[model samples]
Target: MYGHDNKQFFGNNKLLLPEQPVHDDFLDTMEKVFHWSCIFGVFGSKRYISILWSALILASLVVIEYLAIWKVIRAVTGVARDTSGHRSITARLAGTIFYSISIMSLFVASKLWYYWRSNISLLWAKVERSVGVKVPADSTLKRRLYLVFGLMTFCSMFEHTVSMIASVGLDCPSSLLMKRYVLVSHGFLFMGQDYSEWFAMPLILISTLASLLWNFQDQLIVLISIGLTSRYYRLNGFVAKLCELEKHQTEFNKKSEALKVYTWRKIREAYVKQAMLVRRMDGALGGIVMLSCSCNFYFICLQMFLGITQGLSTDVMTGIYYVVSLAWLCTRVISVVLSASGVNTHSKTALKYLYTYETHCYNVEVGRLQDQLTKDYIALSGMGFFYLNKTILLQMAGAIITYELILIQFDGQGQIDTETTPSIHLNVTNI
Candidate 1:
């Protein structure tokens, strides 16, 4: 349904790429991810968009996704309780908190999407028709989307492999111990010692996908911001060209004032419309913005605390995974924060052209545009809790440093040791 012109992405009843390639804009690419596999986005077929289908799919999803999260959280919380080491227990709880945030992000984001889908689509169409100017394809936004997707996919796969390897033995799986380790990772076979691969494996897969919900939500915000930024840029350029043209007009072309005034009025309207679109987007995606910030903040601190306290494993694969995961996590955080911050940057940039553009005939449109960009303060936020900008990066670092100092002071008293006591039992699972 997301394909261009409503064409099938998979054609001829074969699960193969189309004969011709499909070029995806940022919105299309993001929607395609959720449409195909995302728990929240996968709805029933057109044949089943009725009440019965909605209820059935939503109910099944609740059982498979929400119930699974509760089960996993309960299982991990149990492990954390039984664990001997203070730091280890704290880390387990931190992972559970991070997981809970992911679940909530999806729940809220899905609700927002369903309720605001029409509003969002209308905003997109308005962008296309803004100021009677066409929105050119934004190649840069598409590239960023691809880069983000590549980094996230690699990060998730690498983390999953390392967590699996660390939980199981260093040796390849051949015996019952390795098999049991897999099930125990999800808390299905251990404690009670009742092993059922069937139930556990499916839930594990669903849990893994749920983990990607955070990524999906993050990328969606980034791409949408970039998308709006691109449109604002085009609007700015169009206005600038008019300003320059007016500045150089000859006496014979003085009648063009009427045309320029009309154009300026349109530009003013476009700028206002763009700003309104930001607010609409905020309402749709804002609920999860706080979750995005919180989860990133929590996970970065947890990974750093563990790396500093325990140091990386001497085992080469484990050590590499630790370092790479930490670095990749930071990259993801920086990418997301910067992407949204650009929206604020570009929104204010029109003021530069408005002030500097030497128009012979100044009009009320310019003043309105200037005031709209200046005092309006167009930026994404965590549902008005905090704005998304470059400052967040520093704020996060400072908070982490302060938290780490406290944790390290406690570690000196053996809160979390570099070497574990034989009494300690840790579950090496995806954080």
Candidate 2:
């Protein structure tokens, strides 16, 4: 059938417009409208609207991803048979692409939202400093970093929430039963062999809690620094005199120098405190990373063993889980390495400033450099670095968990016969 202006029509009278329209004006108008609408929509949206939308979209994506993964778990554990219909290769490819894109978008949006909020907070801190308020060392930058970390934590909770929801909504009683069986069996595998599985849950929980704490530690430090600095400003004695000396270095070089020594000494004290904070953070982060790795490994082993012993036919869902889990593991490893590197970098910067101030002495340029370096150190120490590290870690964690689940389903189905083993008579004779 055909419609007006040679537009093809379906049997039900639905018009089938040309993919590439013949009329230039129509295409132009459509493009114009699309661009204008997007512009208006973005602009008309309130402040933080992007962050809100991004969070919601990302949360939805996490939910869907988890659901998809759960389907794989079902197939792997033999809790449910694979009912994947006759999906075209193209359709499968498209679905995979969409899922990947959605996951990537979730990550990107989270990072962007964190950056936006952090920048805003940091800007405000800078403004406060400009108004003659003593901004604590790295207060502005730390705030920014914390904001990002806070967002990452929020997103993680959102993902966990989605998983819990899906567990309730999509999972069947049979699947839950199967999961419980696997858990119990795994517990036996550990305990029955004189290995205590008692430490598993506690270790996992502690690691998770520590990870959260490590992520937000910088924020707490910044807040404390801000408060202390504010108090020092109000005291109207040593700190005020120091600030005055800092401002009038040219007129009062000798007096400023004397004040500078005191300031340097105070800064050294602060640096020592900062170093201790860093040490605690490092230990906490390291513990979390190790615990996460061990937990993931255990999960993978347990799932694989159960699937194999049960003689289940792991399906597409299992494959997805395996892929996701492995990916997550890889991410964790990368994050740990990056975090270590960042800490080293921060330490080096701090040391460099300390050396410059103590040895070369504080000059005009040195003072400025010291201030800038301090800010950078503070920023680096904040959640910004931790957030980046954790983002990678979480993604990897998710991927590893997913992949292992898939592996259990798919790899567990095929069994090798041990009864058909070759005779060892020749080897014994040789011995």
Best-matching candidate per lDDT? 1
Any residue pairs clashing in model 1, and if so which? none
- Candidate 2, 347-375: lDDT as tens digits: 33443433433332455544543554455
Per-prediction tally of clashes: 0, 21
Q: Which tens-of-lDDT digit does each residue in 279-372 have in candidate 1?
A: 8887777876877777777677666766665544445555555566677678777877898888888888778778876655677667777777
Model 1 misplaced regions, further than 4 Å:
1-27, 39-88, 134-147, 176-184, 187-189, 252-254, 359-361, 415-431
Off by over 4 Å in 2: 1-252, 279-290, 296-313, 332-341, 351-431
Best by TM-score: 1
Per-candidate TM equals 0.78, 0.32
Q: RMSD for all candidates, in order, please.
A: 9.7, 23.8
lDDT, candidate 2, equals 0.34
Local accuracy by lDDT, each model: 0.59, 0.34
